[model samples]
Structures are given as C-alpha cells and as structure tokens.
Target: MHRQYVVNLSRIREVERRFKGELFLVMDDQEQTMVPVSRRNAPAVRRALQI
Candidate 1:
C-alpha cells in the first residue's frame, strides 16, 4: 500500500543543512524520508524552507 505523509516545512528546514545533491531529508510524524524536489518545485521549496 502507498501511504502519504505531511511533513512540515519547519522540519524540512531543520534538516536543510544536511541537503545532499537535489535531495533532502525530512522527518515526518512517523519516519524519515528523502525528498527529491524537482526543479519546478525547487524554488517554492527553497522559499518555504528559506534555504
């Protein structure tokens, strides 16, 4: 089954310092996952995370 999670932007920024390549780590309420933010969404992600 596929599960969807909602990771807060604050959490994303908390780990932004550890960004690797085009992927970054995010810890949701349950687990951690790497997010591959696409070019299209990169701007928004950066703006949101203030990276």
Candidate 2:
C-alpha cells in the first residue's frame, strides 16, 4: 500500500556538519531517517515543506 506522511518542516533538523554531509533528519516513533539533499536544491525542499 502506498502511504504518505506529513512532516513538519520545523521538526526536521538540517545537519551540515562534517561526516554527516547535507541532510534532513526526521525523527518519529523513536526512529529516524537522514534524507540527503544538495545545497543548491535545499531551497526547493524548504519551499515544498512550506517552511
């Protein structure tokens, strides 16, 4: 089944530190996922999230 999750942009943490690379970290139900993103396209992601 296909499902969709609505994530709060404010809740997502953006990490740009060394060894981590550029990513959007989303944590829920004690589980977390790091979504890789490019610096050039970051603004688009933010816009899509309505942040």
The C-alpha lDDT values of all candidates are 0.53, 0.51
* Cα lDDT of model 1 by residue, 1-51, tens digit: 012434566655234333444545465645666655554666666677666
Span of 10 residues, lowest total lDDT, candidate 2: 1-10
Candidate 1 wrong stretches, greater than 4 Å: 1-6, 13-21, 28-31
Residue pairs in clash, model 1 = none
The top-ranked prediction according to TM-score is 1
TM-score result, candidate 2:
0.42
- State in Å the error of residue 28, model 2: 4.4
* lDDT assessment of candidate 2: 0.51
**Residue 48 CA error for candidate 1 (Å)?**
0.6
